[model samples]
Target chain A: MATEHAHVEEHTHPGPRQYVIIGAILAVITLIEFGVFYLEMDAALMTWIILVLSSSKFLLVVGYFMHLKFDDVRFSGLFFAPFVIMVSIGVVLMALFFNLTR
Target chain B: MQYLSGIDDHRTSTGLDNRKMLMWAFLGSDVMFFGTLIGTHLIYRNRSLSGPQEEILSIPITTISTFVLLMSSLAMVLALAAIQRGNMGSFRFWTAIVCVFGSIFIGFQMFEFAEFAHLGLTPRTNLFGSTFLVMTGFHGTHVAVGILWLWTILFASYKGKIHQGNSLQVEIAGLYWHFVDIVWIVIFGVVYLIGAYGAEGRALEEVHHAARAAGIG
Candidate 1:
């Protein structure tokens, strides 16, 4: 009985309405991104804003659309571990190249 | 509704289906792959000694394609939901929408590439051209593969192979489709918006003024 309950929980997912709401959120974030892109401001500030907005969209898609939020934590552990490492390496590589190019 | 026997394969030691676990592992590796590509692009940004730079990029058109891809993701998830609910009609409808949206995105990319090449920004144009084209070209190829994959699953549905019992197939495809969408979200930000900022003539004007001040031109 406990195994059956676990199996049921594993497959539980949001319905169409919830998915649509999440989709709408993602769309609005993209529009905001477009608006932010056109604004005149400090380049660094603009870059940070774009990063935050894009990260939000990324998390939403991974969490909701991909069901990573409600699904198994092991899956998240498997994916995010490499994800964090690569992002760090990517940033470090950028820093290295920028310095060399400068 | 009849349940698929293999929906949740618990035979594994981790109590997870091997197929889904493998997909996640593949995606994890793909994150590193794209991270390297994106990092290379950023590293070489603005290093093009000559040839067309970011100034020639068409932001408005690319933004529309971004929006289309985002909507296709929504359609993809909806398709999966429809299948899980045993609604084949809705599933077919949304699945076809995803294919159409995917094709439209690819069409926009083709137009952009043609325009850029016409302006002399091929892979050999400069560092910017090489990195930019390679990174985005790989992404476009992934999107193309995803469209074909989804279409195959959709066709299989009609043959009675994709019922609620076997909706895991659709779920797996949805995962791949969403991964493609997320990759584009990152590309749109890092490559198009941030990379092209002020390159739409502002940066060129700045360069001209600098050259004039320095008495070079």
Candidate 2:
């Protein structure tokens, strides 16, 4: 158990400074998302841009702020497995809705 | 055999700490829960039969609220770091800040809800109102619960029950808090930014026509 735990701790967890930097990046992404709302562009292109920006922000919060990047791989698997399935289901449902609406 | 670190001292047979594992499991389930709610909101978008949908959603206000919640996540991580370092003062300070920011986020939500009600938009008004309120309202409930959880941890730290050797308690709470922040990031993007943009655009067009009618522009 001790050796197992030591192996886990070999991964470096971020300090407060790194956490603050991640937070700043998240804030900037959010600002850009809000600004993009007012920009005149192709609606589809705008949607894709917002989705990309928001996903990047999401990854940053999960990776750094949640410390998933530094934690045990098992932990990441536990979280991301369900998340990926959920997102896949969401996409399927939205596609169905689009089909019906069209 | 000795424990690897003080935080990992309570590890289970899987070599992972029990509380942290449980928190992750719970968060995984929560991801599915919010996923359904968000999908519902998106499906019902623009399906309102009556009542205001877009004009009532103020992007600026929500943007500010989103920033507040993001900072709270930062505060939460800082608190976890401080406790791990055994700095009681810094831990308590950052924990208190997290609670404060969490409460401010809730306060903003409450204000928005009340203003929406004032403008005659209620859950019973239309499909959009029902799904939107239910989804965002539940998310607000999660934030409120997180605020209370942080306050409890803050009080525990005050009693000296939470220390460097047992920082996992705060670490788990921080995990939950960050999850809530991430959910709001998605909501802000899907619901507020894109969901309301079309309605707001139409509203702007109406204003333009009114101005032209009055010979003001």
Candidate 3:
């Protein structure tokens, strides 16, 4: 176990510089998301755009800043498995509520 | 660099450090927790029976707050990198900045909540008010907790407890902080932008009705 842990630690993680670049990209995406609110597009199109932009920001943060991209794949599974399930439940609930309300 | 001193101490059966795995497990569960709250808010959106609607939501203010939170995530990752590299000074510096940015985000939330209350939109006022308050209130609680967690880690580092040899301590905290930031990203998109847009449309309809009844349309 000790040798295995040492082997894992031997791998290099990104330095401060790369972290800054990732942060810059995240900040740009966030600004674009805010800008979407002001665009005079179709409401459905605007919603899709916002979802795409925000989800992009979400993936960047999770993959880079959280170090999941470099870490063991198990870590990603640990976090995202429940995320997928939760999102499914949320969508189903939203559908039910929309139908009932209508 | 003394990297081997405390590095191999706590390997679990899965070859991952126990602390990191625990944090991921906790975050996985938190996904469900926040998912439910945000889903409830979305389901109840625009069910308000009276005034003080979503128009009271200032996107400019929330935009600033959202940016602040995003920058805090940057500070969090930098702090983790500093600790891993055994740079205590830089770690403390970045962690302090993270705490400050977290506090600023919370300050924006407090001001927004108070503004809503002043506009007569309390939890008891309407569906929008209730769900909005509960959802954002819980998120604010998470931010407040993160602030306290960062401070605790800062204090521990000062006491010579957290160093590069045990960078996992800082890594766990960073995971929690980053999770909180991502959750806010979802809330900003779903609750603030989409929910508020719906309320704005309803508020416009109300204005139109008032104008028509007054023969001013």
Candidate 4:
């Protein structure tokens, strides 16, 4: 990417071709996730596989298509910090609710 | 440069870009809303006394909707591509199509939820129903809001206000659209697939009981 950045074109950027590439990769990951589900794998393994594949697609869309990776780490931290906190609160809520009747 | 770039590059929005900023703020709040709903749905998943629940979630059907949404994201990118290429015709066409597909997904969701309600469960029914509806409903509202925004942008395109200068605004909106797609992917896996996992557990239990009855492997 740094190498590509060095040869930047001036006067009206042609837009990144990476969008098409990312779309293809996302499709492949989706296919793999579906295949894993119908296979003879255990539930735990299947869950992990789906989670990993989904996260990969998520990051690719965010980092590349959103231009978050190139723009600023501050932007990444700004969005992701809140995202993590929200998920944590969710986990705590789930635990509390589950333990209520236990 | 050898390329004759049709799109303008020096153009930008004023004052931190209101459209982009608004989208970010809304998504931040939406993440919390959905997180809470999904958490509860998962927590009380086993609390259903007579569950006509996620076990009823059909992947092939949901998968088709998911596929539609994924394709919408693709069209969103293509719209951005069209704008960059200075093809307003293509851009408008694609954006309109994206809106159409988004609306279709939401329509299917309405049907699915209606079916869920017809099964004698709803948001006011119980813990399970409340969480299930809220979690999926929150996502549904986002899709509705997106379609509304697409209509506004489509009009803006006709008025010439949404030119290449403010393409960043559209890009930010696309990011939100894609994030919704990603969330649906997780929901399909966790809420639907793992929900199906519960059914798989029941099937396994039935097989075990049958084996014991037959005294066979």
RMSD of each predicted structure: 2.5, 3.9, 2.4, 6.3
For A3-93, candidate 3 gives per-residue lDDT tens digits of 4453465345677898899889988887887788877777788788888888988998998888788889999999999999999999999
Ranking 1 against 2 by DockQ, winner? 2
What DockQ number belongs to candidate 2? 0.66
Off by over 4 Å in 2: A1-11, B1-9, B203-217
lDDT of 4 by residue, B1-217 (tens): 2121212222135313345555666667667767777777888886766545555566667767876887788788788877765788988988998899999999889988888878777887777787778888888888888888888988998998887655665777787887788678778777876677647567566668879999995
TM-score of each: 0.93, 0.90, 0.93, 0.80
- The DockQ-based CAPRI class assigned to model 1 is medium
Task: Give DockQ for candidates 1 onward, in order.
Answer: 0.65, 0.66, 0.69, 0.33
The local lDDT score (0 to 100) that residue B69 gets in candidate 2 is 95
Clashing pairs in 2: none
Error of 3 at B194 (Å): 1.9
Task: List where candidate 4 sits over 4 angstroms from the true fold.
Answer: A1-17, A95-101, B1-22, B198-200, B203-217
B23-131: candidate 2 lDDT, tens digit per residue: 9999999999999999998887776655777767999999999999999999999988887777889999999999999899999999999999899989998887899
Worst 10 residues of 1 chain B by lDDT: B1-10
Instruction: Kindly report which residue pairs in candidate 1 clash with one another.
Output: none
Candidates ranked, most accurate by DockQ first: 3, 2, 1, 4
The stretch of ten residues in a row with the least summed lDDT in candidate 4 chain A is A2-11
